[model samples]
Target: MELFIRPNTNEINQVEIENETGTSDPVVVSINRILQQPDSSYFLEGIIYKVPEPLRSMNSEAYTPTAISIGPLHSGRKDLKANSLKPIYLRHFLNLAQLSVNTIVETVQTLEQRARYCYTEFIEMSRDEFVELLVFDACFVVMHLTSWQYPNLDTPNAVNLWQSWNEISHDLMLLENQLPFFLLQSLYDLFAPSQPLLEHQSFIQIVQYYFSEHKNPKLFFIDIKPLSVDDVKHFVDLVRMPNTRMYSHEKSDQRLLWPLNATELHECGVIFRSGDGIEFNDQGGCLQLPPIKIYDDFEKRVRNLIAYEQCHIGNELRNRVSNFAVFMQCLVQSDQDVKLLIEGGIIENYLGGINEITQLFNNLGKHIFIGINYYNSDCKKMKDYCMRRHHRWMTSLRRNYFSTPWLCASSIAAILLLALTLIQTILAVFTGFKERS
Candidate 1:
């Protein structure tokens, strides 16, 4: 059913989330009607928020000094400059005239802040996990930007070789908050699942199963299997044609995707929605993010570091821990009102709990920082120690995680070799016995 929704924008007003197709009568939506006016407008899932768009793409080839833009809304990093920017590692960030200031990050942040202020209901997860996903998404953007900025015209790799960034001999650094989402997406396509399938039918079966398996059914963070942009496109197509089964039982080709409800379908159609909520139709679930700005040619260089990090970063658990800490700190300290789509899901507080928590922490921080000494000096010191230990535990976790892959690979190889040797010995004994007979 065709449901109408306001596209994500800087100028959002009362937007109605209509369930034109009477399928979903979930308590969440029913509750919403009672709490809010029918005509009242609200932010919905899958709505493409108005974000900074680079006017007439320009990269190193077209512009001098590699004048890449770090959009105001999206730059999570604290520093910004015009000419020479601070290098986070190798890439440089500078505001360009062509790049717009509006970004999804900013828009979302604005809503988050508002929700906090208004005490709106929010879906709560591990602060660190949510942040880790943010980093993961951001890394994807950086990877794409870098890949486009540094095209393979003068290099040996004309094919997608962003994955092999270890060949670089120079000390490269990004001078600012780099686009990370685009980076991850391009690389993700290059390395999708590679198991042998019987046919298109088998392939669809496997792929469908892969997407449906709920490693994090309620939360689509850091799971090994990530939903791609293509998946979203396919899902959009499905929404456009509701009668057609995305995945066919008899046909060799089937598209396995989770269905979206009226509100979810409408919301996700424009802005990307987290896969936790119920779509108008619950065929299954999806992780497909909406289309981001594509990075072509030399612009790809903005991403090499991110690519390298994903492939070479050994401390996965530790990295997650740190990401979690930062995310938690940000969420706990955030003074923003966040929004949560609790229409099709079973979130008790929805977006409300977040506001409550953030407010709780805000008050605590203010009291502690603003001469309202609630805790004694020793207690404060103990708190500090606990934080330090918490961080240390994360580092240790990462170390253990890094060790697993090598250990598993080596063990598997050894076991296979031993099995082969045993088979050979058994064959030899059987042959000798047959010859004697």
Candidate 2:
């Protein structure tokens, strides 16, 4: 029997619909939308970024500003009590500079688009809101920096303001809580010419002086000749300058394999000395590293710095802070390693226990890719130096026998007794031989 073949209704309807209207497929439309979007270079223009999930999840509080928010990322938070001081500081800045509010507003408005481009996220605030925020935040930052010199005695509690300043300093250094350095410079330049205190000082110099005195004392030792204000991205980058300048970029294909912990390296006759950067002397079996000061906020600062490097720095060779973190992680495996580094003066432990220090290093370098480690060659040299059997034996001997004065004296006495016993045996043998003759 011949059956009438029925056409597939859905396919026929789809074909008819396509023919009736000039419409692209859903996927084609999506592809076109994607093609119209900007490239990676557009995103690369952004200096400010939200700390990625892999890092943020590790320590949320480290990346989050506790005291205040600088830029749009953490703006309008009710919990941040320092947000209330922004308007007050803005008024103080205007009064000090003898400039009208419209002057700074116009200045910020002119650079609004440029400032917005600095952030990776799409800022939800309107042009007016964003501009006002910048003016208030920028003024607050300048006043905050010089707050130590110009204490606000008008406030009922001067002591509380001082405490808030310390907290705010840390908050300003956070990766997310940052304004563009150029915007800050522009604002500072407007009033700087008139102020006697800021007459000779550039914004960069002021920043250098403030951070050096308060945040990082080691900044005084770092040669900032290679750094310029134009090169600095933000406060996080400013903090990173000393580290980036500490080491020259060297590429290596080798990875650090079998990295002995600090205590193990010490046992293998490898000496660790605190210095400006990571270096290894094969001849002397010495490893020199800058002394890492572990304070309460040290991990927070380091995490933010690492997060900045991860987001901004494309080249691993230039990821000095991240590379250092990786290197430290390799050297610190346990509390013993931390103690050894502490005893050797390689690490200054201000956070109380060695376990915390150990955990600090161990927690770093997670969920990050380390390419072209700066200390690879030095690590290899150290590992090779440690491989020698003689060095290990000598180190063992010295550590075991000469570790204490009593042990050293006992070792000497034992050696002398063995020598005397051998000499007495020889003398008796000679006498017996002579008597036989």
TM-scores for every candidate against the unseen true structure: 0.17, 0.87
Which model scores highest in TM-score? Answer: 2
Please list the residue runs of candidate 2 whose C-alpha ends up more than 4 Å from where it truly belongs after superposition: 1-41, 149-162, 215-221, 242-245, 256-258, 315-317
After aligning candidate 1 to the native by TM-score, how far in Å is the CA of 348 from where it should be? Answer: 39
Let me know the TM-score candidate 2 reaches against the reference structure: 0.87
lDDT of 1 by residue, 1-437 (tens): 12222123211222232343243444544454445433323232221111111311222222211332332212343331221222221121112112222332343343332222211122132333333333333333333233333332112342342342321201112212222223233323322222112212222222333322312222222222334443322111111111112111121122222122223222232121433221222122222221111112112322222222222222222122122112223323332322222222222232245455344323321111111111122223333333444444644554444448886677678778999999999999999999999
lDDT per model vs. reference: 0.28, 0.76
Give the top-scoring candidate (lDDT). 2
Name the weakest run of 10 consecutive residues (lDDT summed) in model 1: 366-375
* Shift in Å, residue 104, candidate 1: 18
